[model samples]
Target: MAVKKIGIIMNGVTGRMGTNQHLVRSIVAIRQQGGVVLSNGDLIMPDPILVGRNEDKLQALAEKHGIERWSTNLEQCLADPHNVIYFDSQTTVRRAEAIRKAIKAGKHIYCEKPTATSLEESLELAQLAYEAGVKTGVVQDKLFLPGLLKLKRLIDSGFFGKILSVRMEFGYWVFEGDWQAGQRPSWNYRKEDGGGIIVDMFAHWRYVLDNLFGNVKSVSCLGVTHIPKRLDEQGHPYACTADDAAYATFELEGDIVVQANSSWAVRVNREDLLTIQVDGTEGSAVAGLRDCKVQHRVNTPKPVWNPDIENPFNFSEQWQTVPDNQNFDNGFKVQWELFLKHVVTDEPFIWNLLEGAKGTQLAELAIQSWDERRWIAVPELSLGVKQSDAVEASK
Candidate 1:
């Protein structure tokens, strides 16, 4: 069996998410596992060239990972004939321009979500990729998480009959860079730099809701800057121009009500940083990052409500943990392997740029709902009409 090496130009590797998840956990992990095996017994290995602005960081990352290639010249990397795919994990503001340049170079695209700051640019990139006839994909890593995977298995097994509603709680307290250093980049709190909880997180919510439950029909949302001022990387206080918290209610196709709260200021008191509770007529399930617990109708407890009397029911003990019968890999690495196979062996990859545009569409509608303080309908996204066209067409 032969091993084929597919050169990948991975940009924005110096950043936290880029460095930890995409590079180390995913790409490097895939390499260590002997790459992805193909249908024909051949293996397709991802040969990623780390591309970033910082030479020192790039060199250090490459050396630490035992990678041979690292470059600061994105243009030169794109120009190389050997590189078949261009992956970007840059800050949201810079992603569009860089992806456009890569598309112009006729390379396939794989990148992170909320593809662009606006719905117009997101759709534009989708349209451009369609015209260019190049394969494209966006990271939808949450779908591959072990907890969510177990949840999917339960759904498929008819454990949740007539599923009702989903409640999601996601977030943790990020330091303000005053006493302890901020865990997230300071740009995340600045609206000018394409930063906001709604824009950042709604992408994940859109895909998670659409893929597992149903397509979002409408949204009612409230966004707020809970902490108006936070210290920057330099420990200097700056006005937070973006929403630090978002409380959103989404209506899905089956009339499922999804209430999601995403915040960076909230303290952790739940089972995990991200937990999704799915309720149904027959059963219910609560899923965290790596574990899932479920309660069936037969095993569910009934408790009497008496405010004056002390409660005796152990609510948390009623559910049983889902077994990890099979080994689950890192979600990011799993997705990378799938994308690599899709590129080399023509495997089907459903999470394309258009699907990503749908995410951007949801985020935009949520923001609109927040601004208008009313429910906003999610219009079906198609190539028949563009956001830019509607502006001039109205006049």
Candidate 2:
């Protein structure tokens, strides 16, 4: 059996997402499973080279993971013929330059989302990758989540008849960086660092909505920076230039309205950091990060309308917890395996860079919409600088 030696260059291993999701859960998990086995008995073993600016950090990570290679020089790593895949989990502002370099180097790309800070740069990267003929993908990790998968199954099985609307509540109180230690990086609080809840979470929302409910045709959003100032990593106060929260509503193609509220300053009172409630004509389902619950109209609570006194609706009583199934499992690991399979067999993976670009486009347009206080029409992807050339080339 032929073993495909795929060299993966993983940038931003120093970050939380890079360390936990990409490295520990995905790459390390893949290696532990004795590599991914193809149907024809071939093996896809990822020879991942950790790439970052910090030598000490890289060395520590490499040693911790038993990984042989570590490099501070991204260009040098890209120059190597062995490193066929360039994966970036860097700062949103830095992603464009890094990915563009990787694409020009003829390496396939698999990177974290919101591909670029600006939609234009995202489009350019996608166009370049398309023209260069290299495989590209974005990490749409939520779709593979156990709870979300269960919800998808319920929907697929016709548990929810005709989908009506989706309400997503996502957030947790991110500590003020000044008074206390914050959960996320300090850069996430600064606009110049490409830090904003809208950009970060809306990209995830786009795919989730598109996959679960319907295609988003339009959106109206309101973003706010609740905490105007926060402490940096070194305990110095810094002005929070980016929005900490975003309340967005999407108009889908089927007239399905999806509303999402994302924030870093909200106190958690829900099932999880992320919870999605899908109400349909016949039934409804609520999905959290790890669990889901379903309620049919037959099972829905019968309530009398009384507005005089405290007549609060006890809707929780109506829903029944979704039973755990066999495949109710880890999401990050699941996507990682799928990616490895796609890499090995050239499988039909829809979550490509173009799809990623679409997410970026939506987020960018949403921000513009908020700032301009008007609806911004999402432009179709023109692969090149000119529309006519892109159309002809696409054809």
Best by TM-score: 1
Question: How much is the lDDT of residue 253 in candidate 1?
Answer: 96
Residue runs of model 2 more than 4 Å from their true location after superposition: 307-314, 382-395
Q: Clashes in each model (backbone N, CA, C under 3 Å)?
A: 0, 1
Per-model TM-score versus the true fold: 0.97, 0.94
Q: Poorest 10 consecutive residues of model 1 by lDDT?
A: 386-395
- Residues 231-263 of candidate 2 have per-residue lDDT tens digits of 878988899999999988888877788889999
RMSD of each: 1.8, 2.9
**Top-lDDT structure, candidate number:** 1
lDDT of 1 at 204: 98
Error of 2 at 240 (Å): 0.5
Compared with the true structure, all predictions reach lDDT values of 0.91, 0.85
